[model samples]
Target: MKIFSNPNISKVMKIYEKSKKHTSEGVKETDYSKDKLELSNNAKELQIALKAYKNLPEIREEKVKEIKDRIQQGSYNVAGKEIAEKILQGVQIDKKI
Candidate 1:
Protein backbone atom coordinates (compact mmCIF):
# COMPACT_ATOMS: atom_id res chain seq x y z
CA MET A 1 0.00 0.00 0.00
CA LYS A 2 3.00 2.37 -0.56
CA ILE A 3 1.74 5.08 -3.07
CA PHE A 4 5.14 6.89 -3.45
CA SER A 5 6.67 3.76 -5.06
CA ASN A 6 4.42 4.35 -8.12
CA PRO A 7 6.39 6.11 -10.93
CA ASN A 8 3.48 8.41 -11.93
CA ILE A 9 2.95 9.58 -8.29
CA SER A 10 6.69 10.28 -7.91
CA LYS A 11 6.71 12.40 -11.10
CA VAL A 12 3.62 14.37 -9.92
CA MET A 13 5.18 14.98 -6.44
CA LYS A 14 8.41 16.29 -8.08
CA ILE A 15 6.39 18.72 -10.28
CA TYR A 16 4.34 19.94 -7.26
CA GLU A 17 7.54 20.60 -5.21
CA LYS A 18 9.11 22.57 -8.11
CA SER A 19 5.92 24.71 -8.52
CA LYS A 20 5.76 25.38 -4.72
CA LYS A 21 9.40 26.57 -4.66
CA HIS A 22 8.83 28.81 -7.74
CA THR A 23 5.71 30.44 -6.25
CA SER A 24 7.19 31.02 -2.72
CA GLU A 25 10.24 33.06 -3.86
CA GLY A 26 9.89 36.90 -4.29
CA VAL A 27 6.28 37.12 -5.65
CA LYS A 28 5.03 40.75 -5.73
CA GLU A 29 1.55 41.66 -4.44
CA THR A 30 -0.93 43.08 -6.98
CA ASP A 31 -2.72 46.46 -6.46
CA TYR A 32 -6.56 46.49 -6.54
CA SER A 33 -7.10 50.11 -5.41
CA LYS A 34 -8.49 51.62 -8.62
CA ASP A 35 -10.23 50.23 -11.73
CA LYS A 36 -10.96 52.19 -14.94
CA LEU A 37 -12.72 51.47 -18.26
CA GLU A 38 -13.04 53.71 -21.30
CA LEU A 39 -15.12 52.85 -24.38
CA SER A 40 -14.06 53.82 -27.92
CA ASN A 41 -16.27 56.01 -30.17
CA ASN A 42 -17.41 52.99 -32.24
CA ALA A 43 -18.13 50.96 -29.06
CA LYS A 44 -20.13 53.85 -27.58
CA GLU A 45 -22.15 54.16 -30.81
CA LEU A 46 -22.83 50.39 -30.79
CA GLN A 47 -24.01 50.54 -27.14
CA ILE A 48 -26.44 53.35 -27.97
CA ALA A 49 -27.76 51.44 -31.02
CA LEU A 50 -28.21 48.28 -28.90
CA LYS A 51 -30.15 50.25 -26.27
CA ALA A 52 -32.49 51.73 -28.97
CA TYR A 53 -33.02 48.27 -30.51
CA LYS A 54 -33.88 46.80 -27.07
CA ASN A 55 -36.59 49.48 -26.63
CA LEU A 56 -38.29 48.48 -29.92
CA PRO A 57 -41.20 46.02 -29.96
CA GLU A 58 -40.16 42.37 -30.51
CA ILE A 59 -42.84 41.95 -33.22
CA ARG A 60 -44.09 44.51 -35.80
CA GLU A 61 -47.88 44.07 -35.55
CA GLU A 62 -48.69 46.36 -38.49
CA LYS A 63 -46.44 44.45 -40.90
CA VAL A 64 -47.86 41.12 -39.67
CA LYS A 65 -51.49 42.34 -40.21
CA GLU A 66 -50.66 43.58 -43.72
CA ILE A 67 -49.14 40.21 -44.66
CA LYS A 68 -52.16 38.39 -43.21
CA ASP A 69 -54.48 40.58 -45.31
CA ARG A 70 -52.45 39.85 -48.46
CA ILE A 71 -52.77 36.10 -47.80
CA GLN A 72 -56.56 36.42 -47.27
CA GLN A 73 -56.86 38.31 -50.60
CA GLY A 74 -54.96 35.50 -52.43
CA SER A 75 -52.19 37.94 -53.44
CA TYR A 76 -49.36 36.69 -51.21
CA ASN A 77 -46.85 34.85 -53.40
CA VAL A 78 -43.50 33.19 -52.61
CA ALA A 79 -41.00 33.03 -55.48
CA GLY A 80 -39.35 29.60 -55.83
CA LYS A 81 -36.17 31.12 -57.31
CA GLU A 82 -35.81 33.49 -54.35
CA ILE A 83 -36.34 30.63 -51.88
CA ALA A 84 -33.77 28.46 -53.72
CA GLU A 85 -31.25 31.34 -53.76
CA LYS A 86 -31.74 31.94 -49.99
CA ILE A 87 -31.31 28.18 -49.29
CA LEU A 88 -28.07 28.14 -51.31
CA GLN A 89 -26.82 31.26 -49.50
CA GLY A 90 -27.60 29.67 -46.09
CA VAL A 91 -25.75 26.48 -47.09
CA GLN A 92 -22.71 28.48 -48.24
CA ILE A 93 -22.70 30.48 -45.00
CA ASP A 94 -22.94 27.25 -42.96
CA LYS A 95 -19.96 25.76 -44.87
CA LYS A 96 -17.87 28.90 -44.15
CA ILE A 97 -18.64 28.60 -40.43
Candidate 2:
Protein backbone atom coordinates (compact mmCIF):
# COMPACT_ATOMS: atom_id res chain seq x y z
CA MET A 1 0.00 0.00 0.00
CA LYS A 2 1.23 3.53 -0.86
CA ILE A 3 0.81 5.87 2.17
CA PHE A 4 1.31 9.08 0.08
CA SER A 5 -1.71 8.07 -2.07
CA ASN A 6 -3.88 9.32 0.83
CA PRO A 7 -5.01 12.98 0.40
CA ASN A 8 -3.69 14.16 3.80
CA ILE A 9 -0.30 12.43 3.47
CA SER A 10 0.13 13.73 -0.11
CA LYS A 11 -0.62 17.30 1.00
CA VAL A 12 1.90 17.04 3.87
CA MET A 13 4.62 15.65 1.55
CA LYS A 14 4.04 18.48 -0.97
CA ILE A 15 4.31 21.10 1.82
CA TYR A 16 7.50 19.49 3.18
CA GLU A 17 9.12 19.49 -0.31
CA LYS A 18 8.17 23.16 -0.86
CA SER A 19 9.60 24.20 2.53
CA LYS A 20 12.89 22.34 1.83
CA LYS A 21 13.24 24.05 -1.55
CA HIS A 22 12.56 27.51 -0.07
CA THR A 23 15.03 27.01 2.80
CA SER A 24 17.76 25.74 0.43
CA GLU A 25 17.40 28.85 -1.76
CA GLY A 26 17.50 31.22 1.23
CA VAL A 27 20.75 29.82 2.82
CA LYS A 28 23.88 31.98 2.38
CA GLU A 29 27.52 30.81 2.48
CA THR A 30 29.22 31.39 5.87
CA ASP A 31 32.88 32.51 6.37
CA TYR A 32 34.68 31.33 9.53
CA SER A 33 38.18 32.70 8.67
CA LYS A 34 37.93 35.62 11.16
CA ASP A 35 37.24 33.50 14.23
CA LYS A 36 39.30 34.49 17.35
CA LEU A 37 39.63 32.94 20.82
CA GLU A 38 40.71 34.89 23.92
CA LEU A 39 41.54 33.07 27.17
CA SER A 40 41.03 34.55 30.64
CA ASN A 41 44.04 35.31 32.90
CA ASN A 42 43.30 32.29 35.09
CA ALA A 43 43.01 30.03 32.03
CA LYS A 44 46.36 31.31 30.69
CA GLU A 45 47.98 30.64 34.08
CA LEU A 46 46.54 27.11 34.12
CA GLN A 47 47.85 26.43 30.58
CA ILE A 48 51.36 27.53 31.64
CA ALA A 49 51.22 25.39 34.80
CA LEU A 50 50.00 22.38 32.75
CA LYS A 51 52.89 22.78 30.28
CA ALA A 52 55.43 22.94 33.14
CA TYR A 53 53.93 19.89 34.82
CA LYS A 54 54.03 17.94 31.51
CA ASN A 55 57.80 18.62 31.26
CA LEU A 56 58.41 17.26 34.77
CA PRO A 57 59.36 13.62 35.47
CA GLU A 58 56.34 11.33 35.89
CA ILE A 59 58.09 9.44 38.70
CA ARG A 60 60.76 10.73 41.12
CA GLU A 61 62.98 7.63 40.94
CA GLU A 62 65.75 9.20 43.06
CA LYS A 63 63.38 9.91 45.95
CA VAL A 64 61.81 6.48 45.61
CA LYS A 65 65.25 4.78 45.67
CA GLU A 66 66.29 6.78 48.75
CA ILE A 67 63.16 5.69 50.61
CA LYS A 68 63.69 2.09 49.50
CA ASP A 69 67.28 2.15 50.77
CA ARG A 70 66.14 3.62 54.08
CA ILE A 71 63.52 0.93 54.42
CA GLN A 72 66.07 -1.85 53.63
CA GLN A 73 68.39 -0.48 56.33
CA GLY A 74 65.49 -0.40 58.87
CA SER A 75 65.69 3.42 59.16
CA TYR A 76 62.53 4.56 57.33
CA ASN A 77 60.58 6.50 59.95
CA VAL A 78 56.99 7.73 59.39
CA ALA A 79 55.66 10.20 61.95
CA GLY A 80 52.22 9.25 63.25
CA LYS A 81 51.35 12.92 63.84
CA GLU A 82 52.04 13.76 60.17
CA ILE A 83 49.80 10.89 59.01
CA ALA A 84 47.03 12.00 61.39
CA GLU A 85 47.33 15.62 60.14
CA LYS A 86 47.06 14.51 56.51
CA ILE A 87 43.99 12.34 57.27
CA LEU A 88 42.34 15.24 59.07
CA GLN A 89 43.13 17.57 56.15
CA GLY A 90 41.53 15.11 53.71
CA VAL A 91 38.43 14.86 55.92
CA GLN A 92 38.15 18.67 56.06
CA ILE A 93 38.41 18.87 52.25
CA ASP A 94 35.70 16.19 51.88
CA LYS A 95 33.42 18.13 54.24
CA LYS A 96 33.96 21.33 52.20
CA ILE A 97 32.99 19.48 49.03
Candidate 3:
Protein backbone atom coordinates (compact mmCIF):
# COMPACT_ATOMS: atom_id res chain seq x y z
CA MET A 1 0.00 0.00 0.00
CA LYS A 2 2.99 2.32 0.60
CA ILE A 3 4.94 3.91 -2.37
CA PHE A 4 8.15 1.92 -1.84
CA SER A 5 6.39 -1.31 -0.82
CA ASN A 6 5.94 -2.54 -4.43
CA PRO A 7 9.58 -1.66 -5.23
CA ASN A 8 9.18 -1.15 -9.02
CA ILE A 9 7.98 -4.58 -10.14
CA SER A 10 7.59 -3.24 -13.69
CA LYS A 11 11.27 -2.21 -13.78
CA VAL A 12 12.24 -5.65 -12.46
CA MET A 13 10.16 -7.22 -15.23
CA LYS A 14 11.90 -5.03 -17.83
CA ILE A 15 15.28 -6.17 -16.55
CA TYR A 16 14.15 -9.77 -16.77
CA GLU A 17 12.92 -9.24 -20.35
CA LYS A 18 16.21 -7.65 -21.35
CA SER A 19 18.10 -10.54 -19.78
CA LYS A 20 16.04 -12.99 -21.84
CA LYS A 21 16.71 -10.97 -24.98
CA HIS A 22 20.45 -10.93 -24.33
CA THR A 23 20.41 -14.70 -23.88
CA SER A 24 18.46 -15.24 -27.14
CA GLU A 25 20.24 -12.67 -29.37
CA GLY A 26 23.62 -12.52 -27.59
CA VAL A 27 25.64 -9.30 -27.31
CA LYS A 28 27.15 -7.38 -30.17
CA GLU A 29 30.56 -5.70 -29.99
CA THR A 30 30.95 -2.08 -31.09
CA ASP A 31 33.39 -0.95 -33.78
CA TYR A 32 36.05 1.22 -32.15
CA SER A 33 37.90 2.31 -35.28
CA LYS A 34 36.39 5.73 -34.50
CA ASP A 35 36.04 5.45 -30.68
CA LYS A 36 32.42 4.26 -31.07
CA LEU A 37 31.21 7.78 -30.45
CA GLU A 38 27.86 9.28 -31.41
CA LEU A 39 26.15 12.52 -30.50
CA SER A 40 22.67 13.92 -30.95
CA ASN A 41 22.13 16.32 -33.89
CA ASN A 42 21.55 19.08 -31.36
CA ALA A 43 24.75 18.30 -29.46
CA LYS A 44 27.01 17.58 -32.46
CA GLU A 45 27.70 21.31 -33.07
CA LEU A 46 28.45 21.79 -29.36
CA GLN A 47 31.03 18.99 -29.52
CA ILE A 48 32.78 20.68 -32.44
CA ALA A 49 32.71 24.11 -30.74
CA LEU A 50 34.09 22.67 -27.51
CA LYS A 51 36.96 21.07 -29.41
CA ALA A 52 37.74 24.39 -31.17
CA TYR A 53 37.54 26.42 -27.94
CA LYS A 54 40.09 24.09 -26.29
CA ASN A 55 42.45 24.73 -29.22
CA LEU A 56 42.54 28.47 -28.36
CA PRO A 57 45.70 28.93 -26.27
CA GLU A 58 45.88 32.68 -26.85
CA ILE A 59 42.36 33.19 -25.58
CA ARG A 60 43.07 30.97 -22.54
CA GLU A 61 46.59 32.27 -21.72
CA GLU A 62 45.74 35.94 -22.20
CA LYS A 63 42.95 35.64 -19.63
CA VAL A 64 45.32 33.80 -17.27
CA LYS A 65 47.91 36.57 -17.53
CA GLU A 66 45.21 39.21 -17.19
CA ILE A 67 44.12 37.65 -13.89
CA LYS A 68 47.71 37.33 -12.62
CA ASP A 69 48.49 40.95 -13.38
CA ARG A 70 45.28 42.13 -11.83
CA ILE A 71 46.02 40.10 -8.67
CA GLN A 72 49.50 41.63 -8.28
CA GLN A 73 47.96 45.09 -8.75
CA GLY A 74 45.31 44.25 -6.06
CA SER A 75 42.47 44.84 -8.54
CA TYR A 76 40.66 42.48 -10.92
CA ASN A 77 37.94 43.40 -13.38
CA VAL A 78 37.02 40.85 -15.99
CA ALA A 79 36.17 41.68 -19.60
CA GLY A 80 33.35 39.15 -19.83
CA LYS A 81 31.88 40.09 -23.22
CA GLU A 82 33.87 37.47 -25.16
CA ILE A 83 33.09 34.64 -22.70
CA ALA A 84 29.40 35.53 -22.69
CA GLU A 85 29.42 35.58 -26.47
CA LYS A 86 31.10 32.16 -26.63
CA ILE A 87 28.61 30.64 -24.16
CA LEU A 88 25.68 32.06 -26.08
CA GLN A 89 27.09 30.70 -29.35
CA GLY A 90 27.78 27.28 -27.81
CA VAL A 91 24.18 26.95 -26.65
CA GLN A 92 22.93 28.27 -30.00
CA ILE A 93 21.14 31.09 -28.22
CA ASP A 94 20.61 34.20 -30.29
CA LYS A 95 22.43 37.36 -29.24
CA LYS A 96 19.07 39.14 -29.31
CA ILE A 97 17.93 36.82 -26.56
- Over 3-95, each residue of candidate 1 has an lDDT whose tens digit, in order, gives 999999999999999999878763645445788899999999999999999999999999999999999999999899999999999999999
RMSD of each: 9.2, 5.7, 15.8
What stretches of model 1 exceed 4 Å from their correct place? 1-33, 88-97
Candidate number that wins on lDDT, 2 or 3: 2
**Candidate 2 ranges beyond 4 A from true positions:** 1-35, 91-97
lDDT of 3 at 53: 86
Give the per-residue lDDT of model 3 (tens digit) for 1-97. 6653576976787799999988776545543465577779879889899999888775668788888998999897656998898887977866456
Error of 2 at 44 (Å): 1.3
**How badly does each model clash, as a count of residue pairs?**
0, 0, 0
| TM-score of each model, in listed order | 0.54, 0.52, 0.27
lDDT tens digits by residue: candidate 2, 1-97? 8997789998999999999988887775544478799999999999999999999999999999999999999999999999999999999999999
Q: How accurate is candidate 3 locally (lDDT)?
A: 0.78
